[model samples]
Target chain A: MDSLLTLLPMLVKMAIVVGVLLLLPLPLTWMERKIAAHIQQRPGPMRVGWHGLLQPLADALKLLTKEDHIPADADRRLFAMAPVVALVPPFLVFTAIPFGTPVQLFGQEVTLMISDMNVGLLFILAVSGIGVFGTILAGWSSNSKYAVLGSLRSIAQMISYEIPMGFSVIGVVMLAQSMNLSQIVAAQEGLWNIVLQPIGFFVFFVAGLAEAQRIPFDLPEAEGDLGAGYHTEYSGIRFSLFMLAEYLVVVMLAALNVLLFFGGWNGAPPFVPEPVWFLLKVGFFVWVFMWFRFTFPRYRYDQLMTIGWKVLLPLSLLNILVSGLWML
Target chain B: MEQAFFLLLAAVAVTAALLVVLARNPIHSALALVACLVQIAALYVLLGAPFLAVIQIFVYVGAVMVLFLFVIMMLDVRKEAQVRFLRGPLLPGLVVLAVLAGEMIALLLHSTRLHAVMGPGQPVLEQPSVADLSLLLFQEYLLPFEVASVILLVALIGAVVLAREDGASAAKAARKEPRGAAR
Candidate 1:
C-alpha cells in the first residue's frame, strides 16, 4: 500500500510527460511548415484550418487509415519494430529533463522531472544514443540501396558528431562540478554557462544539430541524393512515428540547450513562473532550429564528417582546456 | 520482491545469451547480444551501480553493437544463412559444458559459506559514488588507466593501418581486372 502510494505520483507524471510529447509534434509540425513557407515567401497549410492548425490532425488520420506497407524483400520483424525502437528512446530522454523545480500539488511536493539521477546528463546521453538503432534497423530491414546508404551515412554522422557533442558538455560539467542536470542549472543561476563557455555552446549547438539530424546536418535523410533516405520504404503511421521521434529530439535538444547553456528555468522576471521562463527559452531555441533549417543548405556528407572530426572536436577540446583554466 | 526482479532479469539475460549463440542470422545474433548486454545493465542497476549500467548501455549496446550491425550489413551476410553453424564434435563440448555446470552448482551450494564470512543480510557490496570511483580511477589507478588507454590508441592505429592496406590491395586488384565479368 505504501509502495503503491509512492508509485502513484510517478505514474501520473509519466502519463503527463508522454501525453505532452505525443501531442507536441502536432503543433510543432504546423509551426515548422509555416516557418518554412514564410521563409520561402509563401503561405503554408491554409486549407485544413486557420493557418492549417488542424493540418497535423488530418495528417495523423490519413496516416492511420493508409495501408501499412512492407517491401517483399524487407525483414518483416525488424521492419515492423524499427519505428518503435526509434521512438521510445526520445520519450525515455524526457524522464531526466526537468521543466521546473518542485511544486506543491495535492499537498505533495512533486518534482517536474520524472527522475533525478545523480548522473542525469549521462543517462540522457546514453539513452538518446540508442535512438540510432532505429534508423540503422529501418535501413537494413528495408533491403533498399538508398535506405542502406542513408542509414550508413547517418550512423557515421551520428557517431562522429557524438564525440564533439559529449566533449562540449565537459566544460559545463567542469563549471558546475556536477553531472546532475538540476545542479548544473543551479550553478548557472548566477550567470549562464553560455556567457562563460561560448565556444562550448557553439560546438554543442553544431554537434547537437548533427545529432538530431536537422539541416544543414541532415545527410541521413538528404532528399536530393537519397530519396527520403532511411525512411524511403516506410509509409503511413510508421513513417509518422519516425517524424514524431525527430521532432521530440528537436525539443529535447532545445530543452538541453536551455538547461546547459542558457540556465534552465532561470532569469524569471517578477510575476513570471520558472516553468514559463523555461518554456519560453525552449520555444525560442526550437524556432531557432527551424530558422536554421530554412536558412542553411544541407551539408555535403564528406564536409559534414570533416567539420565534426576536424573542427568541432578540436574546438570542444580547446573549450574544455579554457574552462578548466578559468576554473583554476 | 528485489530477489524476484533479479531472477526475472537473470532469466532474460540467460535467454538472450543463448539466442545470441543459437540464432542463425548474424544480425539476429548481434541484436541478441545487445539484448543480453542491456539485461546485464539492468542487473547493474539492480545491484545499485547505475553509473556502470549507463556506461554499459552507452558503450556496448549503443556504440559497439551498432558497429557490429554495420559490419553485418556491409558484409551482406544473407548467403551465410544457408551454412551450418555447429560443426565440432558434440561429446567434448558436452563434457566441457557439464564441468562448467558442475562448478557453478558447487559455487552456488557453497555461497552460504561466503555469506557467513561477510555476515548476514549483506548480499551485495555497496557501490562507491561516482566521485569516489573517478578518484580511484584517476588518482589511485592512474598508471594502469593511462596504459589501458594507450593500448587502445595503439589498437586503433593498427586497425586503420590494416584497413588501409586492404583497401590499397583491393584497389590494385580492381585496376588490374579490366572488364571483369565475375564482380
Candidate 2:
C-alpha cells in the first residue's frame, strides 16, 4: 500500500511531463513557420485561430487525414519502424530532466521528474545520439540516392560536431565537478556557469545548432542539394513524426543548454518559481535558435566539416586545457 | 522487486547485445547497439551505479557509437560484404571467445569468495561520487589521460594528412583537363 502510494505521484509526474513535451512541439512548429513568415515579411497563419494559435492543430489534423505513402522498392519493415525509432529517444530523455523540487502529495515526496539518474547529462546525450540511427536507417531503407546522401551528410555532421560539443561540456563538468545535471545546476546557485565558461558555452551552443540540423549547419536538409534529407520518402503522420522529433530535439538542446550554462532553475531574488525560470531560459535559447535559422545561410559540405573539425574541435580542446589549468 | 527488475534489465541487455552482433544491416546493428547501451544503463540503475550508467550511455552510446554509425553510413559498406567475416577466421575467434569466457568465469568465482560489506539489503556498493572520479582522473590517472590525449591528437593529424589531396596530383589533373578543353 505504501509502495503503491509512492508510485502514484511518480506516474502523475511522468504523465504531466510526457503530456507537456508532446504538446510543446505543436507551438514550436507554429513558431518556426510564424518566425520564418515574419522574417520574410508576411503575416503567417493569422486565419486558423487568434493569431494562428490553432494552425499547428490544423496542420496536425491535415497530416493525420493524409494518405500514408510508401515507396514501392523501400524495405517495408525498417521503413515502418524508422519514425518510431526517431521519436522515442527524445521522449525518453525528458524522463531524467528535473523540473522542480520534490513535492509532498499524500504523505510521499514525489519528484517532479520521471527519473533522476546520476548520469543525467550522459543519458540525455546517449539517447539523443541514438535518434540519429533512425534517420540513417530511414535513408538506407528508403533505397533512394538522395535520402542516403542526406542521411550520410547528417550523420557526418552530427558525429563531427559531437566531439566539440562533448569537449565543451567537459569544462562545465570540470567546474561543476559533477556530471549530474541537477547537481551541476545546483552548483551554480550563486553565479551561472556561463559567466565562467563563456567559450565552452559558445562551442556547445554552436555544436547544438549543428546537432539540431538548423540553418548554416543545415546542409543535410538543404533543399537545393538534398530534398528534405532523411525524410524525403516519408509522408503523412510519419513525416509529422520526424518533424516532431526534430523540434523536440531543438527543445531538448535548448533545455540542456539552459541546464548546463544558464543555471537551469536558478533565478534572481523574489524567487521566480523554478519551472518558470527554467521555461524562460529554455524559451530564450529556442528563440535564439530561431534567430540563427533566420540569420545564417546553409553551410557547404566541405565548409561545414572544416568548421566542425578545424575550428570547433580545436577551440573546445583549447577551452578544456585553459579551464583545466585555471582550475589547477 | 529490485532483483526482478535487475533480472529483466539483464535479459534486455543480453538480448540487445546479441541483436547488435546478429543484425544484418550496419544501421540495424547500430540501432541494436543503442538498445544495448540503454539496457546497460538500466542495469547500472539496478546495480545502484547511476552515475556510471549515465556516463556509459553518454560517452559510449552517444558520442563514440554515433561516430561509428556515421562512418559506417558514409562508407556505405554493404550488409552482404559485412557478412563475409562470419565465413572467415573461425578458429582465432573461438579461441579469443574461450579466453574471455574463462577470465570472466574466474573473476566471478574469485569475487564470490571475497564477501565485502555492502549496504544492508540493498546492492549499494559505495561507489565513488563524480567528484572522486574527476579527482582520481585528473590527479592519479593524469599521465595516462595526457598520453591518450596525445594519441588522439596524433590520430587527428594523421587523418587530416591522409584525407588531403596532394598539390602535385591536382596540378597533373589540371594539366590533363586542358587537352579535353581544347576540343
Candidate 3:
C-alpha cells in the first residue's frame, strides 16, 4: 500500500506526459503546415482557427470520421496490427527521454521526463528498431504488389541506415561514457556533444531523418512511383496512425538529437523554466526537419543505399576512432 | 510477482518456439521465431540480466530476425507444406531432442548446485554492468573474442559467395525482373 501510494504520483506524471505527447502532434502539424507553406511562398492554413491553428482538430475529426478499410484478401490480423505496432515504439522512446531536471511538485521532486533508464539510449534504439516491422508487415500483409515493393525498400533502407545511427551515437556514448540519457546530458555541462563530435551530430541527424522515414528518405511511400506505397491500401484512422507514428518518431528523434548534441535544458540563463528551454530546442529541431523535408529532393533508392552504406557508415566509424583518441 | 512475470514470458517463449516449427506459413514461422526471441529476451530481463536482454533484442531481434522476416517476405513464400518433422531421421532427431531436453531439465533442477550463489531475491549470477562485461571480454576473453570475429568474417564471406550469381546467371536472373526485362 505504501509502495502503491509512492507510485501513484509517478503514474499521474506518466499519464500527463502521455497526454502532452499525444497533444504535441496538433501543434507540430500546425507548425509543419506553416513552415512548408512559407518555404514554398504560400500562405498556409489560415482559416480553421487564428491562422488555421485549429486545423489539426478539423483534420483529426475528418480522419476519425472516415471509413476504415481492409482489403478483401488482406491478412486481417496483421493488417489490423501494423499501425498499432508503428505507434508504440515512439511512445516508449519518448518516455525514456529525460526532458529536463527534476521539478518541485507538492513538496516532492518530480523529473520532467518519464523515466531515467540506465540503458535509456540503448532501450530507445532496440524498441525503435522493432518499429520497422510495422512498415514491413504493413506492406507484406496488404496483398498488394506496390506495398510489398515498398516494404522491401523500407526494410533495405532501415538496415542500411540503422548501422550508421548506432555508430554515430557511439561517439556520444563514448564521450559521455554512459548509456544513460540524463548522464549524457549532464556530461555536456562544459561543452555540448555537437562541438566535440560534429560529424557524429550530422550523421545522427541524417540517420534520424532516415530512421523516421522523413522526406528525402521516404522511398517506402514514394507516392509518385509507388502510389502511397505501403499505406496505399490503408484508409481512415489507421492511415492517420501511420502518419502519427512517423511524426511522433520525428519529434522523438529530434528531441534525442537535442539531448545528445545540443545541451538538454541548457540555454542562456533567463527567467524561463528548464523544460521550456528543452521544448524550444526540440521545436527548433523539428522545424529544421520540416524545412529539410520541404527543401530537399528525395534520393534515388540506389543513392540512398550508397549514402548509408558507403558514405555515412565509414564516416561514422572514423568519428568513433577520432572520438576514442580524443577520449584517451 | 517476478516469478509470475517469468512464468508468463517462459510460456510465451515456449509456445512461440513450438509455433516456429508447427506453423504452415513460412512468414508465420519467422514471426513466431521473432516472438520466441523477444520472449526469451524478456525472460532474460526477469532473470536480472537486463544488459544481456537488451543486447539480445538489439542483435537478434533488431538485425538477425528482421533480416529473416525480410527475406521470407521478399521470397514471397506463400504456403509451405506441412514439412515432415520426423520423416526418416525420427530416431536420431528424437534422440537429440531427448538429450537436449534432459540436459535443460537437469540444468534447471540443479541450478542452485552450479557456481553462483543467490540470496533471497538476487540474480542467479551477479548482474554485471556493460563495463564489466566489456572488461571481461577484452581482458580474459580477448583471444576468444578475436577468434569469434574471425570465424564470423569467414562465415559472412562464405554466405556472400554462396548467394552471389555468376555473370551469366546474374544476367539471366536480372532478365526475370519486370523492370530488368523491359530494359
Candidate 4:
C-alpha cells in the first residue's frame, strides 16, 4: 500500500503524457485537413462543427461504433495485437524526451519528462526497432498480398534509413558530448546545434521524415499503389490506431528536431513560459511536415531506396566527420 | 521487491522460450522469441547494465528479429512441420542437451560459492556509460574490434556473391531445364 501510494504521482504523470499525446492527434488531424484544403483551394471539414474543429471527434465516434474486423484467414491473436503493439514503442520513446527545461515546484526541480537516462537517445532508437516489428506483424497477420508487399517495402526502407538517422544523431551527440536529451537541450542554450551542424540537422530531418514514413517516403501505406498499403485489411479503430501512431511519430520527431537542432525553449522571450516556447518551436516543425506533404510527389520505390542509401547515408557519414573536426 | 520483479521476468522468459520451440507455426515461434528477448533485456536493466540492455533491444530484438520475421514470412514455413520433433537427431541432441545442462548446474554451484566468499546479495557495481565502452573498444581491444569488423565485411561480401551466383544458376536452370529450378 505504501509503495503504491508512493508510485501514484509517477503513474499520474504517465497518464498525463499519454493523454496529451492522444488528444494532440485530434487537433493535428483537423489541422492537416484544413491546411491541405487551403493549399488545394477548397474549404475542408467545415460542416461537422465550427471550422471543422469537431470533425475529429465525429470521426472518433464513427470509428468506435463500427464493427471490429477479424478476417477468417487471418491469424486471430496477432491480428488483434498489431494495432496496440504499434502504439507502445513510440509512447516509450516519448517518455525519454524532455519537453522543456525543468521547472521549480515547491522548491524542488520538477522535470517535464518521465525519466532522464544517460542513454536516452539510444533508448529512442531501440524502441523504434520494436515499432518496425509491429508494422511487419500487422502486414503478415493480415494475410493479404498487398499488405505483405507494402510491409516488405517498409522494412527495407526503415532499415536503410535508420543507418543515416543513426549517423546523423551521432554527429549531434559528438557536438553535445552527451546522450541525455535534457543535457543536449541545455547545451544548445547558447548557440543551438543548427548553427554548428546544419548538414546534420538537414539529414536528421529528412531521415526522420522517412522514419515516420510521411508523404513521399510513405511507401508502406501508399494509397494509390497498394490499396492503403499494409493496412488494407484494417478498418474502424484498428485502422485508426495505425494513423494515431503515424501522427504520434510525427509529433515526437518534431519535438526531437526542435530539441536537437533548434534552440529548445530558448528564444527572444521575456513573456512566454519555457514549455510554451518549446511547443511553438515544435508547432513550426509540425507545419513544415504538412507543407512537405502537399508539395512533393511520392518517389518511385527504387528511387526511394537509392536516396536512402546512396544519398543520405554518404551525406550523414560526411556530416559526422565534419562535426568531429569542427568540434575539435 | 527486486526479487519479485526478477521472478516475474524469469517466469515470462522461460514460458516464452518454451513457446518458441513448442509452437508449431514459424511465425508464432518468432513472436515467442521476441518476447523472450524482451524479457532478457529487462533482466539486463535489473542487473544495472542499462547500456547493454538498450543495445540488446536495438541490435537483436529490434533489427535482427525483424529480419528473421521477414524471412519466415517470405518462406511460409508453416506447412513444413510434417516431421516429428527431434526424430532424426534425437539421441545426439539429448546427449548434447544433457552435457549443456550439467555445465549450467556446475556454474550455478560455483556462483553460490563465490557469493559465500562475498556476502548474501551481489553488490551493485559502478555503472559504465557508452563512452567508457567505446573507449575500451577503441583503446584496449582495438585490434580485436578491427578484426571483428573485417570479418563482418567479409561475410557481407560473401553473402552478395552467393546471392548473385544463385540468381545466375536459377536463370540458367529456367532456360535449360524449365523445372527443378533453384528449389
- On residues A1-328, what C-alpha lDDT tens digit does candidate 2 reach at each position? 9998768777887888778878888899888889989999998899999999999999999999999999998888989998988898889889888876666767767776787766677778767877787787788788888898888888788788878988899999888877777888889889998999999999999999998888888877788878887889999999988888988899999999999999888874476877887888899899889978988888788999999999999999999999999999
Candidate 1 steric clashes: 0
Predicted structure with the largest lDDT when compared to the true one? 1
lDDT of 2: 0.83
In every candidate, how many clashes are there?
Answer: 0, 0, 0, 0
- TM-score of each model, in listed order: 0.95, 0.85, 0.92, 0.93
Pick out the ten consecutive residues of candidate 3 chain B with the lowest summed lDDT: B78-87
User: For model 1, what is the C-alpha lDDT against the true structure?
Assistant: 0.92
Each prediction's DockQ against the real complex: 0.72, 0.54, 0.62, 0.74
The CAPRI-style docking tier of model 1 reads medium
Candidate number with the higher TM-score (3 or 4): 4
Candidate 1: tens digits of C-alpha lDDT, residues A1-328: 9999999999999999999999999999999999999999999999998879999999899999999999999999999999999999999999999989899998999898999888889988899999999999999899999999999998898889888999999999988888899999999999999999999999999999999999999999999999999999999999999999999999999999999999999999999999999999999999999999999999888899899999999999999898888888
Interface quality of candidate 4 as DockQ: 0.74
Question: After best superposition, candidate 2 residue B68: deviation in angstroms?
Answer: 3.7
List the candidates ranked by TM-score, beginning with the highest.
Answer: 1, 4, 3, 2
Residue A201 CA error for candidate 1 (Å)? 0.9
Q: Which residue runs of candidate 3 sit more than 4 Å off their true CA positions?
A: B79-103, B106-127, B165-169, B172-183
Q: After TM-score superposition, what is the CA distance of residue A209 in candidate 1 from its true location, in Å?
A: 0.8
